[model samples]
Target: MKVSFDPDVAMLLRRVAPAGVVWVLLALPSQSVYADDYPCRVALCVPSPTNPWSIAACVPALERLFDDLAHGRGWPTCEGSGVSMNYVNTPFDPCQGGLNEAGPGAWVIEGKKQPNHPTWFYTDPASYGISPSASPQQSAGGDAVANASLACVGKLMGTYRTYVGQYNRDYQEVNVAVYDQIVWQKPQSPWAIDVYQNGQFSRRVHWK
Candidate 1:
């Protein structure tokens, strides 16, 4: 979730960048040979981030990401493809009441529907169910990572929070805080990226 503005913000993002901020798409296995071996349909969406610290980058209009993840091998995220990419954004505080340097502008994501508000603020399984996800069977993480993180934060605050995305692919496991920071885009080795902003990859570097 990036705020569109003067080149300054772009330049800022270019330098600091979000963590796991895949500057480029991940490379995938050739579909002609291993199409059937991939996981569930991939879905991705880049939510509009109105400010920093907002939980909007997590989920937004996800139909497109879900589509490509499920149908287009050319754009991995679905079967034979890999993971999904999506974004959500928090609204800017006109009054500048939030804890943001440039007003309350933050990016957010919504992989799972939240509770009791409107849209992300208020969600109900009975009314707005969670997205379809692959069984945790072959997953390396995903729901599990979410559950784990929730257990820690939920217990501390004594209130349930949002679920985070945990890549469940077979290739590798990666820390996803990158979605927020946008700085981990370019990392040195020891960090064999199994997952990237676009999808999955082999040994190579790309700049988005």
Candidate 2:
């Protein structure tokens, strides 16, 4: 699937992926359309990577919680709790932010129609100050999962050592990083899709 994130989700992903601190009310009234006193959904979304680890580990657990809440999985009492979790993931596992982003990782989430969404990301490494072809990670893809944003992609850039290191040992490290922002027009062509890196547009894709 192909997708894009709202500015709010994109902003949050770029900020928190590097372990930046974000503040929110975290307490909302039991009902919507309430007063300004409504609680906020304060949270962070980052990449999960490892031998068996992932850039999306915490996502499914949170998704399950959403299901639980919607299902009323015997947790109606949990509503409006001081803490609430929100997360998103795609391509199933391995997380594009992880070391093997280009390998065989695809989150496969149902998303809006976009074309050639994955090639820019999985085809190259993220090389700074270089052209897209030179930088493998210059590519980008997004869906409902803003976790698929710049911060997580930063984890992709930091993957240099993984490829250079002997035996190519796994390298899963998320450090401070900055994003420029990726913005694009809704695709004019049915096959074309937008791509963003560092919260900004790196390029667009066309249908085969």
Candidate 3:
């Protein structure tokens, strides 16, 4: 579903747009636009001391991953702790905080920073698979937001690193301006998130 505002409407929006507002034009996949059976809201849980979109501010690589996942396309490689689908059958509560434990593996999000990079952040979508065009500023902002969100979730989930660090966690910072650039970019659609885990791929997490 390619969603575009008519030029006239766009002009009108721009004229009346609030300060700091940016308009985006997107050509999104149909699966992203349509509803689905997966009631559980899923987020990409890249634990391993790392963390990793929508409207939802998203990039081409992210969008592509969602599209590919919906169509039975292959998995995108992940580094460090690898990715997992932390699912919450109900909305809010667990989904906003973190996923619950399941089975023997103790499905929890936990990790310490990888040895090579202490101040590491997961921002490179290309490393996973596709490297869509993105400016340095856009990438940096996205990385900041991703790291912040990860740390926030990690702290909430009672992770050792986040708890011990005494870092001032602000979940609100997850939506800071720096990260907004990634989603506000033009020409791409962002509907959901996909992650490869447990020797198989998780379902496409439809946009809320």
Candidate 4:
């Protein structure tokens, strides 16, 4: 049988293929998927190498994040209790700062998406001083099980990484990171966040 997958899913499968992972396709229902929705039906509409800020759902939060990064603002949070998102340049460090500071790594964004919508978005990453990678090594999970997403893309100028685990029934949060020219290392405790379905996030403790 012929089966298709989201760009993020397809990329994940390729990356995990070396581990001998068996691919299984499950039928999902069409609904308003986001961090704020209950029984969260998250559909990752943004694709890697593209600025998530362009997505209608991700505009608000991502725009805020970009602003914070540009101004050296503290960590940004989502709309929910005990939920926040952090952007760090170094791995495993609570000090969230600009990706240009890290000096080595790639910034990426991985997630699930509605099968009907194409992963590509007409967004400009250059505005954030971020460029696309022909082949990105960093990746994350987007299955319903995780009910979350991640981003680890870019180059020394700005490498990104994050893991958005399910925060609660009301919302979800993401951990975004950027690397420099060195290498990509997983964070010790990726920032925790709680996000609503509308793309709004909360700012909590920063890692600077």
Candidate 5:
């Protein structure tokens, strides 16, 4: 899972500005080559809080998390690898949004959609065996996006934590207890998501 960066890509990484740099790095000619090698597409649903600025602020962290998952774990494998990651804004509460709004618990892989599934990389302490009342430490001003992104990454990687907060009520709990349980369906329908949680397996359910 050690991805080797081409010389040009390495140079670009060092010189590019930090804001939204992940997109630029991933768009390099080398990455296109990698895509050609793998030949599959992936779309990720990143959390988008109510604050408008939060999405822009969190873009870097989201990109990094996406890259880590894509490269570190060899996800969307050669059999399923056109490799496109889309970041959709989702409200914190699943019940708050209208049909047009990207509410919580939405999921999409490739082109297929699973409207009832929790957003990919989303976390709720209670679902991971932590107390329902424990809250995450509040991030200081300007650091909120970074901290949020880190938490998402940690949860996606199966790093359990204990935290209590009022917002816990807003998050929809997903049963994915570990990262490995997130699986792609067979090659016949590679875009399908198959999840194993709490001793039960759930297949890719069409968006309602």
Candidate 6:
């Protein structure tokens, strides 16, 4: 008998190939098979260019996350209470006086969306102790900070996939918007990630 399979299920079977053959055979095809063909959209929220993190760090980290997801490394899970995002804090002087150094700089993975709505995964920044002038010793000149930020992006990517899969299974057009407001120290500039259901990345939109 001929059987139908959703794109995501096909992808999953491909991941575990030979070992998953039996499972794939046993799995039932989606009730609404036509839904998996629709396009999937994604958005990224960016902080103002004035924030060093946005230009010098966050962008690259985000790019890395997208590249990894496109290549298929699987997404991260958001099941616990602790913060799943990472950031690098840099001290900023608002009044131009060094006497009172206020922490107002950070680069982070805000969160992803499910279909057309936002699904926040990283909610507790304070719990992570994000502070300006805080640098990972192992990073040795921003490497550690960048890695941490990338890790956070990776987790966010996982969440994005979960939402995308749901939309695809439902045969609904996927609209994902990632918002970046985790850094209160800088102005927020949102961006987006656009991709088709066939795994084609459309474009990255940077909002003014």
- Candidate 1 per-residue C-alpha lDDT over 1-208 given as tens digits, one digit per residue, 9 for 90 to 100: 3424334334433533445543222122245423332222122222123221122221221333334434643443343223443321211111122211210111122233335646434332222232345111111123332212110000110112233335563344322210111111112222111233434321221111
Worst 10 residues of 6 by lDDT: 37-46
What lDDT score goes with residue 55 in model 4? 32
Off by over 4 Å in 3: 1-58, 86-208
Predicted candidate 5 versus true structure: per-residue lDDT over 34-53, tens digit per residue: 34432111221121112211
Cα RMSDs of all predictions? 20.8, 19.1, 20.0, 22.4, 19.5, 23.5
TM per candidate: 0.16, 0.18, 0.22, 0.20, 0.16, 0.17
- Cα lDDT of model 2 by residue, 1-208, tens digit: 3345545445544544334333322122233322221222212322111111122323333343345645656221122222322222332222232222322222211112124555334222233333333212222243222323222221222222213113556433322122222221221223222323344433332322
Rank the candidate models, highest TM-score first.
3, 4, 2, 6, 1, 5
**Top lDDT prediction, candidate number:** 4
Candidates' C-alpha lDDT = 0.26, 0.29, 0.30, 0.33, 0.30, 0.28
- Stretches of model 2 off by over 4 angstroms after superposition: 1-81, 85-134, 142-208
lDDT for model 6: 0.28
Candidate 3, residues 91-170, lDDT tens digits: the string is: 11112234221212111232223335332343233322222442122121222333122111223211111111125753
Winning candidate number (TM-score): 3
Model 1 spans > 4 angstroms off: 1-54, 61-63, 76-194, 197-208
Q: How close is candidate 3 to the true structure, as a TM-score?
A: 0.22
Ranked candidates (lDDT, high to low): 4, 3, 5, 2, 6, 1
Cα error, residue 62 of model 4, in Å, equals 0.6
Over 4 Å off, model 5: 1-46, 50-54, 73-208
> Which regions of candidate 6 are displaced past 4 Å?
18-20, 25-208
Q: How many residue pairs clash in each candidate?
A: 48, 21, 2, 47, 14, 10
Kindly list the per-residue Cα lDDT of model 6 for residues 1-208, writing each as its tens digit.
6665545444433432333223323233342431221111011112111321243222443454445555765332222211122122333112221222112121233443335433354233322333434321111123223322111112322212212125446433222212332222222232333222223332232332
lDDT of 6 at 102: 17
Clashes of 3: 2
